[model samples]
Target: MSQWMTLFQKEVLEMWRNFKWIWVPLTFILLGVSEPLTSYYLPQIMKSVGGLPEGAIFEIPKPTAGAVLASGLSQYSTIGALVIVLGTMGIIAGERKSGVAAMILVKPVSYFSFITSKWAGSLLLVWISLFIGYISTWYYTGQLFDWVPIGEFFQSFVLYGLWLTVILTVTVFFSAALLSPGMAGFISLALALIISILSGALSNLLEWSPSQLTSYAGVLLTGGELPSDTMPAILIALLLIVILLWLSVFLFKKKELAA
Candidate 1:
């Protein structure tokens, strides 16, 4: 426990030194605020820059608040996820390359403690960034559009956060197991993309996929009936995260000790 705490502190300090603590949440916050702000004033923005010919009449319908929030979340699903993957792709790989992981392992520390500390640090960043972004989006969406029900808002937020957690866990696993950060990032992102595509393609057959979390989030935001299978999907995702974390620790220990 003490070793884990010390390693966790080192991870936190590393993040601060890298300015991840500043820029990551800021990126998310900007995404959240910009999405709704742009959506609310899109017509005006289009008129200003669209370069319409004389007296062109454009009839654009305003979207509901739910639609606006959903749009923002879609951005989160793509661009936001991409940014996070790229940022964290090197967490374990870079340390190994720099001999940091070897030095840490040479101490009286368990591989579980080292990996868990890294996971905790990464999760802290992910959660903080998402929370700031989501809250900002919710507030702006309520002001520009109608208010999303608080119950639904939090439900969707938590669900979407799980999707992100899954992404981070996969990244960590690859980072620890792979030699190249670029390859790790590519593989992790590819897997995530495949999962998302498969979830949509096989929705009827695969009711317990982690990708369903994003769909369930959209449903919550849009006031649709909550899918009955949501709990099963959540359980499956949590199990997958645990499995990945354990794999990362095991692989890191074996590979690092052999070095």
Candidate 2:
């Protein structure tokens, strides 16, 4: 307990010194504000463009705060992929590059603490940002659209939080397996991109993948119920998080940190 606490403190220090303090907060805040703002303004812009040319066959949902918030939050599909992939890009790999891992090893910090702290810090940052963005978007959405049902929106927000945790776990796991942050970042990017593409191909077959997770959130935001059929996918997400976090520990233990 004490060791983990110490790791947490040390991790916070490292994160601050490395400039993540600015990066994480700014990213989430911007991400948060964008959703509501876009949703609020898009309808007016389209009207100025000429009100759908006097009755196109398609119907646009009345622009509301929830609509905007959902649109903005959907940006997370891209934002999240970029943020997590970059966050863990050089974690262990950087230590290997700079020879800091060896010096840290000589100190009382075990590789376990080192790896654990890195993840703990990153995860903490991710969780905080997500929560902030969630709250802000919720507030703005309500103001812009109408009365967003606070209770139901909160439900979807919490579910999105659960979804994020799983994605982060997979990213960190792959990052831990690598030799450098560059490699880790590439792998993470490849993983995210490939999965996204694959999700389209296997929408019917692989609806449980992270790719589908984003679409599911969009549906839920638009008043779709959590899919009873997706119990398997949701469970897979939980199981994968456990597996990834454990794999990160295992890989770090054998990781030839000197290499």
Candidate 3:
């Protein structure tokens, strides 16, 4: 308990010292602004595009801030995913690279604390950034069109949260198990894409697979019907998160850390 607490504090302090501070929030903010801006202006943008042939009619969805925001949630979520994954790449990689772990290995700090602090810290950074993106999307979306479809909102965010949970666990596990941070991040992304492809290839087990986190979420977030059956999909995603997180911990514990 003491070790975990100490490591947590150290992790927090170190993160603060090294962090650029504004960038995390700014990433979400930029996405937030981009969402509504794109949604509201897309029609005009299309109209402005060069050389629409005479009598060629292009229909643009009338802008509603709420609809724009919901769309933003879907679009900006990709940015959140990038933020989470890349932040994870640096968590363990930095310690191994910077001699930070070498010095700590001499002290009483356990490998568990060292790795666990990183897991916790990286998760904190990802979740907080995701939340900021979510809120900004909502606020700007509301301001742009003022009317939101309540059902779409619920369905979208629930899927978003579940997807985030799965990605966070996958990234953390790979970051711990892989030989380097960049490899970990890229390998994890590849693993995710592979799962998606396999799920499509198999086609029958799509509902139980993690790919639903992306596809099913995209459907609801884009103002489509929310299937009542998605609950089971979310449950499977949650189970995967639990199992992978433990796998990460077990691998870290067994690794031959000098400390």
Candidate 4:
């Protein structure tokens, strides 16, 4: 218990020293604020930058607040996910390369403690950064368009956040298992993309897949009628998170640390 607490504190301090606590939230806030602002001003923006031939008229339809929020989430799905991937890709691999892993392991510390501490720290960062960003998005969306229902907004956030955590967990697992941070990040991103794309293409056929979590989140945000049943996807996603974290611990325990 003492070692786990100590390692958790150390992981947090490392994040603070590295300035991740500052930049990661800032990045999310920027994305959140920018998405709504751009969506609201898109028509004016297009007109200002127009090279339309011969007095062409382009009428842009204003999007609802929920649509704006969904668009913001779409941005996070791509750019925000990439940022998280890069930020965390090195969590364990970098430690191994620097001999920090070996030093820590040489103590009486358990591998589970070491890996879970890192996971907890990374999860903290991910949740905080994403919450701040989404709150900013929700606020800006309300200001620019109609306010989304508070209950629906909260539901959307929880669902999307689960999907995001799954991605982060995959990255952490790969970071523990792989030697190269780039490879870890790449594989994690690839896996996330594949899941999303496949779920999208297959739709009802793949409704049970974890990718549907993001889709469910979008539906909640957009006030769209959800599928009659989606509990399976939610359950599957939660199961995957548990399994991946377990796999990460298992791999970390089996792998030898470099000195």
Tens-digit lDDT track for model 3 on 188-247?
777766876786687565767766655665556554665655777788888897788778
Pick by lDDT: which candidate is best? 1
lDDT scores for all predictions? 0.89, 0.71, 0.69, 0.87
Name the lDDT value of residue 118 in candidate 1.
Answer: 90
Local accuracy of candidate 2 as per-residue lDDT tens digits, 231-256: 66677777877778777878876766
User: In order, how many clashes per candidate?
Assistant: 0, 4, 3, 0
Pairs of colliding residues, candidate 4: none
lDDT of 4 by residue, 42-137 (tens): 989998897998778899888888888988887778888998899999999999888889888989989889888898898899889989999999
Query: Model 2, residue 99: what's the lDDT?
Result: 81
C-alpha lDDT of candidate 1 relative to the true structure: 0.89
lDDT, candidate 2, at 15: 87
| All candidates: TM-score | 0.96, 0.84, 0.81, 0.95
Identify the runs in model 1 with alpha carbons over 4 angstroms from their true place.
51-56
Query: In terms of TM-score, how similar is model 3 to the real structure?
Result: 0.81
